[model samples]
Target: MIERLLGTPYERRLLGGGRFSGPTAWLIAIMMFVMLSVAAAGLALAGSARLVSEGVARRHMAQITDGRSTGAAAVAALRAAPGVVSVTPVPEAELRRTLERWLGPSARDPDAALPIPVLIDVELAPGAAVQPVAAALKRAVPQAELISNSGRLGPMLRAVNSLAWLSAAIVALVALATASAVVLATRSALAAHRATIEVMHGIGATDEQITRLFQRKIAVDALAGGLAGALAAGIALLLISAGSLASAGEWTGGRLLGTLDLTLLALLPFIGAALATVVARRTILHSLRASL
Candidate 1:
């Protein structure tokens, strides 16, 4: 059905690609670009949120200032715990380095250099309660404090999830704008060519033939716009991925956030094109029915 509609030449000469499309293609392209960007953001946000929400991804720090079973003993005890997954004690020097990397020039002062916490990172199995890990750490080292600082992370995840929702809403608005443009253009074309269409009908042309003719141009215009938008978005995402990767340079195991694959945004063009085509066809069919 689609092939036949696209193949129709009479509609091509009638709509001629130039009469109706003009700057309308540019409008769709711009709308598609913004839509696809939002779509990419929404997809990445959802994936990151799911990763952070996982129970197995939970991490805690055993900040030991002074403890009996400190360092190796604490790591071994935590390793043997039922719910615990892994225990790696961070070296003081490495901790200072990480702080310096984040703090920059402020961390260079010898007198102002603060004492880094003796941090032992604890990983838990999926769905495991933090209570068991904390209990095991306290039992092993009386002075080892369980620093489950997921308190601040909860708000961040909520914020990402909210941003995802906002992105999705923006995509919806863009889609509406594209559809509206197609509908309005189709109507204007129909109004301009009404007499020619009626004359064709008087000869023998069915309403379907006339409708399909106009639809071919609408589909072509939509596809052109969609392609432009898709290419722009694909280039932008590729550039961004080259700059930042999710697994690279992560300090916290629990708070893994950068982006999931934004390649899904590439499909937005086809989606937008299909949406525009459908809206145009429906509007044309309705207009034909009303004219009769």
Candidate 2:
């Protein structure tokens, strides 16, 4: 049944080629380029957004130990500090285990390491002033130094947000270009098949039938293009992931990399097919009406 449908004279007429031709190849190439470009841009935006959010979430000190005073006293001072929401005292053994989990077996050797500092996990009030709070902590706890989470995270968040905006702009441009390309391609295909369409009409073919034929052809072409484009984009992302993993090495702890979710990746082909079908059908119908 599939072979009969694909091999029919009507299918050839709809496709504007003999299964393989210059116009068909060109249309496929253009659609693939557009789809891949859009996909890449979307992935970039998602990665940037994730990086920014994670940076914000992790903007706090992880460990603080007091060598001059008892660990319990240090925890008390931190808890009483203004703008601090809560402070949880983590034991030395727990701290060592956490470090070992992130830094590997070498970090677990207690003899070679300095006495692990008592970790006080601080939760600050929302909209609290960070610099003033850090200054107050420094004065209150002589053995404690302010760990500047913002120093590492602030610049990274800014960079990621900027990149996200740039990627969004690129995606918009790609979408506009794709729409224009589809419109022009459909117009050309309609012009080339003008005589065939007129003959079909003369022989009593309905407008709906002709519209369906063109829509089917456009959908098939788009599906092929979308598959090719999505494959290319996935390979590109994999290469990027591999490079990042290689570069991160031992420092890969607590780092989150953004990736395209399966759902978004799966939706691309269907979106492409729908867009192509709607655009092709609209263009053909409008042209037919003009001819009438």
Candidate 3:
């Protein structure tokens, strides 16, 4: 539509291709920037929640206080149990290394030699009942303790759910505010150009033509504002990532923003433009009809 309006003389006259009033462009830019930030935050938090959920859902662990031999027994029993997918006995030395990675240089301190329990990781088949599987393991290895993190999963799932709702609300509010901004701009332009529009009406120009001019103009302004907003959002995200670099690995499991995630976020500018165009056209149509 913008390309089609390039050679339209009257549309050009109406648009003027100059800066809109002071607050209009800034209003859009600020709104879009906040929207982008909220969107990115929601996405990142949701990703973290998903990681926690998947980590908990896909696996369970059994701790053996007796020794490796007892842990091995638990592993064998888990393998033979129905709905058991696979079991891996975690070596004490490997556990020590993992602790070391987390604790860093402090792990080498003499006080760091605290006893770590032997661990056996268990995976269940799809749609399997955890209680039955856990009971079977306990029966097979009477000394083994079944660790169920009902509390952990519950909180993570709830947080994910809450984030989803919050993100939706933020998106809805941003869209409403953006549409309102476009409508206000259209009304202002129409009020300022009433005489010109009336003359155009007398000369046989349809309301749709005038609406297109406003749509194209608003869309272009929104595109510019959206791009500015996106850039600001990008900078903020980068700064945050930089600040959290030391803990990013431990926090997000080393996979924070995948390519697909960033790709979706990058579409905000175009979406803003389209939204602005729709709002402007609708406002123009309604106003024109009311006047007629």
TM-score of candidate 2 against the unseen true structure: 0.64
For each candidate, what TM-score against the reference?
0.76, 0.64, 0.74
| Model 2: CA > 4 A from native | 1-9, 13-38, 41-45, 48-52, 55-139, 142-148, 245-260
Local distance difference test scores for all models: 0.74, 0.63, 0.76
Clashing pairs in 2: none
Which regions of candidate 3 are displaced past 4 Å? 1-10, 17-22, 63-136, 243-246
Question: What is candidate 1's TM-score against the reference?
Answer: 0.76
Residue-wise C-alpha lDDT for candidate 3, range 1-292, written one tens digit per residue: 7457453665666656554443556777888888888887777766667666665675788877746556666777788888888888876667777888887766545466566677888877767778877887788777777675545578767867698669868977997988887788789988988988898899998998877766777776777788888899889878887867437547656565557768878997788778888888889999999999
Question: lDDT at 21 for candidate 1?
Answer: 53
Where's the lowest-lDDT run of ten residues in candidate 1?
248-257
Clashes of each: 0, 0, 0
Worst 10 residues of 2 by lDDT: 249-258
lDDT of 2: 0.63
Query: Candidate 2's residue-wise lDDT over 65-178, tens digit each?
Result: 535255565666666767777776666677677888777876678766555765566667766666665665666665566565556766766776677567667656665666
Off by over 4 Å in 1: 1-5, 18-21, 52-56, 64-73, 90-118, 125-129, 142-144, 246-264
What lDDT does model 3 reach?
0.76
Give every collision pair in model 3. none
